[model samples]
Target: MRVLHLSDTHLGVDRWFRGAPTEWSRADDHLAAMRRALAPAFAGEVDVVLHTGDVFDRSRPHPRVIAAALELFTEVARIVPLLLMPGNHDRHGLSWHFSALPAGLTVVDKPCALQLAGLRLAAVPFLRDPAVWAAAAAASCAEGVDLLLAHQCFDGSTVPGFVFRPGEQPDTLGVQHLPRGGPVVLNGHIHTPQELRLGDTRVIHVGSTERTSFIERAEPKGALVWHADGGHVHRVDTAPRPMVIVRGPGDLRTVEPEALVALGREARTLEMEAEVASRGGWVASWPKPSPQMPLFG
Candidate 1:
């Protein structure tokens, strides 16, 4: 089975640097990345597009963002089946969207086993508790699951600077909780893309298609194409917005006009940041009171 794996699209996310109402440029950044990520699906290069989680930035996204997401997914689904497992960020919202979502788009949010393209795979969405996730994995074995689509942080998953171990983080899944000996488990949540061999199981973190924050600025954003025949996985690049961090406002003088510039903590004003942003550079207010800013969607 050839699968195009993508995660953490985070549609509808608004950044603080652009000021109160979203300019939709940041949303456009994510949307542009989404197009690159879904290119394979649209071109019939892959049999299925497996989106692990975080379809939207938040559960209750604006109606316009929801419409944009629906339109995109609906388009991709027309080409091939888009298998989605809701992640922690938008599980509740997905539950609502998939209620009347198109037939080509599927919400595999439960511990259910299904056959697709002659592959027996188990679909497990993001579960809040580690034990419950393990239980779901165990139940799927009855169907001889060969692939796992999950949205949880497993042991050894890394973010920008921190690594997650079984006991180190809340809701972290131990390696032992996985189905042993050759079942491929693709995960989400941790934005950094990495693949590790834990015992016989291959845990591949299908990182977000777009950089969600400055922390992921250094990480190469892309999607993974996994061929189940030999368990071989290769990454395909996505053209996400470039995130650049400057030490102070003075540094912005030499910054690239198209880059998402994270201003230094030099006590800058939003108006000043917006002024620089007006010149095509994505200027974000650094060290904002709320840490959830990602410049845009």
Candidate 2:
């Protein structure tokens, strides 16, 4: 059995930054990336599409985002069976919002095990209460399960430059806490794709499809394709738009506009920081440069 594992699509996100494209453009990029990721399924290359979580950017997605999701998933469902679990961002009230999912799409809102084509799939959705989540996760793991799909952070998994905000729990679940010695664990939440071994089980982090921020610019954005017979998984690049950061010394007035425009043309989002010599010391300022502006200094 072959499976296409994808996660963290984060649809409806409207990121705003200097020299960045419009919100609609960013949304379109995500939609396009998802379609590219699903190409194998469209070509009958995979048996099922497993979406780990974070289907929408927010708990309550915008009407336009919902419409876009429906259109895309409906088409994808026609090609292959889709199994989606909700992540932290959209876990609170996802069922009510997506009550009318397409025919081939199955939403796993609760902890449960599904048997498909001689494989047991154990799915665990995001739960805010840690204790409840732990219990649900434990209960979801059943004997003879071939795969474990979850939407939570794992211990010892780190995304470079990721800083936890104040009052935000890390929500770390250790490998020992999970059901051991059976299924291959595939997880979401961490945008960076990774594979790790814990005891006798292998944990794979199915990364996000779209570059949500500058921090994720360097990470390879894509999905994982797993072949059950050979027990092999390969990463397939989904071609996410690039994000570029450019820094220079001088005030906004002295910065060259042509350079910013050139960089913006090459990347979907561009961030520029200029350091100017102040009376006391150097101060950093981020100026929004226009493509048609004059170039100086």
Candidate 3:
């Protein structure tokens, strides 16, 4: 059974490219990436389509994204069964959308297991409490399932400069909490496309189909075609648009938009805590008394 594993499409994410040859909406970029990535599936290349989570950028997706989603899933589900698990971004489930979806598309909103195209799939949506998530995973794996779908951060998943590992970070999924061997686990949440190990379990971080943030400018965007019987995964590039982050202390006007843009002068940092965070930019806010920092040992 060959499965196309992709996640964090983050549709409706309209970003402005600081430096690009032509101006285009990132909302269109995300939708295009998804459409192209699923082309193979539509061509009868894959047996099933698995999306770990973060179907929309936010809990309440706008009308355009919803329409695009309906068009994509509605068409692809016709060719093969689609198993979509909601991620943290999808806070409250997309009931109206999921409810209207066709039979071939199964939304793993809750912990459940089912069979699709002779393959057994066990899934659990994003849970806040690690303990509760572990219990839910244990329950889902109690019975053997060929494929396990989830939306969580496993130890060792990376972003731009940081890595999620075993530490005081309570959200990291532990090795012991997972079911080893048997089923191949596919996860979403982290945007970086990479493979992870939780003890003996084979965890594939089905990364975002397109880069969702400027921090992800250096990362390649694509989907993974997993051949279940052979246990092999092949990455299919979705041709993500280039995103440039203007940084450093240099002349911004002379910087070329096509190749590399030099930053001699840094963009002015914001003094407000919530403003920058809301803008999807980094902000360092110190706690009352933190003789502690989990990000670094």
Evaluated with lDDT, which candidate comes out highest? Answer: 1
Candidate 1's C-alpha lDDT? 0.78
Q: How high is each candidate's TM-score?
A: 0.88, 0.79, 0.81
Q: Which regions in candidate 1 have their CA more than 4 angstroms from the true location?
A: 18-23, 249-254, 267-280, 286-297
Instruction: Rank candidates, TM-score, best first.
Output: 1, 3, 2
Worst 10 residues of 1 by lDDT: 16-25
- Best TM-score goes to which candidate? 1
> What lDDT would each prediction earn against the true structure?
0.78, 0.70, 0.73
- By lDDT, is 2 or 3 better? 3
- TM-score of candidate 2 on Cα atoms, chains taken together: 0.79
Which tens-of-lDDT digit does each residue in 202-250 have in candidate 3? 8898789887765776788888999987899999898776544445333
Better TM-score candidate (1, 2): 1
Residue 54's lDDT in candidate 1: 90
Consecutive 10-residue window with the lowest summed lDDT within model 2: 276-285
Give per-residue CA lDDT, model 2, range 44-93, as digits (tens): 89999999889888888777788878888888898888887888888574
Alpha-carbon RMSD, candidate 3:
8.6
